[model samples]
Target: MKQPLLTTDFLDRAVDLFADDVGIVAEDGTEYTYGEVGDRVNRLSNALRERGVEKGDRVALLSKNSHYFIETLYATTQLGALFVPLNFRLQPEEYDYLVGDSDPDVFITDAEHAGTVTHLQDEGGVDEWICYDADDAEAGQWDDYEAVLEAASPDQPERPDISEDDDATILYTSGTTGDPKGVVHTHRTQHYHAMVHAHHVEFEDDDVLLWTSPMFHINGWGHIYGLTGIGGKHVIVRDFDPQTVFERIVEHDVSFLGGAPTVLNFLLEHNEEHDVETTGANPVRVETAASPPPKRTIRRTEDELGWRIIHAYGATETGPLITTSNSPRRIQDGDKYDIVNKPGFATINTEVRVVDEDGNDVPCDDETKGEVIARGNQILDRYWNKPEATEEAFTDRVEGWFHTGDIATMDANKMLTIVDRKKDVIISGGENISSIEVQDVLYDHPDVRLAAVIGVPHEKWGETPKALVVPHDGADLTEEEIIEFTRDRLAHYKCPTSVEFREDLPQTSTGKIQKFELREDYWNDDEDRRVN
Candidate 1:
């Protein structure tokens, strides 16, 4: 009656119920069945234990998406070691900072980041190095990942008496705002989050999921748990390539995948050029987040790509999935877009509220905007080793609710539509303008490929909206044309006062536009600049 919940339950389920089923398709075309993967996971766990990695030790992984990456996740957690996934896109300096901060007992990575790993071990004092793709000589000092597994016994290690609240993983935030904060999630939190995620996404054993989102980002938005829990197959990709994604989906018969709006745009453009076939008996379900895609893009995903789009919203701290736009079947097709466009209701076992500055819930009139706050079993309890940051995240105004720092509005149906990030809101001449609103308008322009709205310092208005536009190939769109385009669609004050054209916008590893990076130059000396 009082059994502790753990993420390993998903792994156990997969091994027990779907032993012969193909569990993962690696980027290099290697396939691992559930039973084989489970054996490898046990061997990896035993190897870590043999190397003196004990419970509560942090084991850092810095690699692209692969079978090795997923196997390491299960193995590290099974031994009750805290899994710390490093963003592979980070520089050596960033790696040093993360490795130093986490103080992992063992560091596992691939050949691609061997240089970074070498730097970290030399400079950051990383205790042990395990290289998955290294040759015997290349891995002379470090442990070869395969060799360690080969030498270790395949028997499953005795289960540690792990508590539900025991730390399972430490996922560092994207560091878009500041130095990355390590968001720690317990086994219970991950398990509950996965269960709710599986429920909302309708994951089934027959479903073949694609790894569009990076495994480093909130554990691929909990798919590593949710899909695995349902015994679904995962098609892993090292990076998001439009053509590669298309091929994998068709090849694996991928039922679902998740990504940011930018990823969807790339796929759409790829389809236009190559006409990648997505039509099949199983329509691939595309879950988009990080910023809501324009309704037009969502419609095109369904009409052109023959995929159903599910929009959801959350951050790394909220088990990365608090709200989803899974609509009822009875809703008319015409009204479905509206449902999918909104972030929709809180997932089961989660409470999501839009609150005013004073922490009181805003009216669900669909007009009043407020900061979104969430509290759930899956929500993180604290930032690892950062008490001040943890305190700041959970305000005294709301006891349990974690301040999401996202500005949003809720409809009468409790459907939440994100207006903008709290800092991304353009406050011009005392009026709060949602940057998302301006960007949504800019997206309507046929020539615009990608658009990002930032609050640029203005002498008159404190800060005025500025638009960064990436035009379609061969399209010569003028700055004036973009400004006038938004001016006609939005309020003059809400429209961008100036526009800047770029071949592309600065983005995080997860494909989210780094608006703060864009804002730094404009607001460098401005005292009104908000830093989170």
Candidate 2:
């Protein structure tokens, strides 16, 4: 009665019970049932084995949101191989660095990025190359993805004896500071996250999830596992097009999905041009992470769009679901804006705390800020190859809790509100100011579309808060007007001293604004760049 928990159990359950149900609807409008998808996973596993990918070998994939990505995840894990999903937006040199670091045995990519891999095949250190949507003539040493699947038998391969502690995947962080670190997760850790997510979001077998977020980002925040485990249908879109997303929700009857606040903003903007009913008998529920949406955006999303919004907070090391704002009663009785604004309570079986510099619990007076730390079965065990980084991440200020490097405050109800990244906090005239607080005020402006706040080198104050804003499509917003707008709401020190208009802000693949990039030009002349 003591069977080990494994990720393969999710696919096995779906195959055994929901085989006849539609499991995936690709962007090409082709549908595949659970039974058919299961066959493909088996065939892919067999093909990898034939290619000499043994247990513990790293199988890396670089592709967009597609059915092939899902198959690769199950196939790689089924054979007890560690899956490494790479960000497609990275440069060739960045890809070279990751491939070199992870030491993947097989590197797989789609046609759009085949050239990048082909150029790196000489020095990428990968043993095998697999290309999807590649012509046989163009694929030199690379194996065609479809051809390999076509040649392999559909029989399920013999799975290796995998333990719950076995490494299931190595997800690379965004590398805001320097080179990306590989955050390794065990089968049990991921399984726990999937179970918690399924329970928190109340995912049912009838739920249809749209793939708005890339599958590469924490396995689309674990929906690839959590949603699939429930035998829910997945509608895969190649990319996030506001109009296309609205169309898919209606076309596939999508019940749930996840994205960042930026994606939600895009959908809201799209609705201004076209009419789309997001709420009805089956109102679409969206799970948003990254930065918390401004209170105005949250209210508009629910009242105007009619879609329920769930806010969550976590990092790559925390299985990406440490806390979620998912209380039905709170949303029903309390102010919806206030409830959804907070990151909500710690997830089931997870412990989240805000600790001071000495590792003591911060007062839950709702105004005191401290470093957010988490400990649970779902937290990552270590970095892949960096022992020093691994040690520092876990034992820096606390013994067991993973230091999240985020500053947050917990309310009396235990709802957590993130203030800012520890490194992004602006210090002006010896006073600390949260960049998120300033950006939230800027987001309230009717002319602003997306905004980022960074601390720039100042002669007198040492460092001052500067704002970079992207205005609405047709709004001709002036810097003086934008500065006055924020000055009216927030404290004078927290308001931006200057404002710069841009067409768009630099963002990571997950829709997080890269503040470091915004600060680069401003702090270039200074030898000692004050990140704080």
Predicted candidate 2 versus true structure: per-residue lDDT over 266-334, tens digit per residue: 888889768776643467898889787888788778787888888998989999889989998877978
- Candidate lDDT scores, in order, read 0.86, 0.88
lDDT of 1 by residue, 1-532 (tens): 7889998999899999999999998888889999999999999999889888899998999888889888999999999999999888877778877887899988998877777657556554667788976773342367788988999988999878889899999999877667789999999999999999888888988998888888888888899988987899998988789989988888878889987888888899889989878754577888888787887788888899988888888999999899989877624643877788888889997999999988899999988999999999999968998999899888755866799889999988888999998888888899999998888889888788899998887889888888999999999998889888988998898998788999899887677888877877777776347453
For every candidate in turn, the CA RMSD to the true structure comes to 1.7, 1.5
lDDT of 2: 0.88
The lowest-lDDT stretch of 10 consecutive residues in candidate 1 is: 133-142
- lDDT of model 2 at residue 29? 91
Best by lDDT: 2
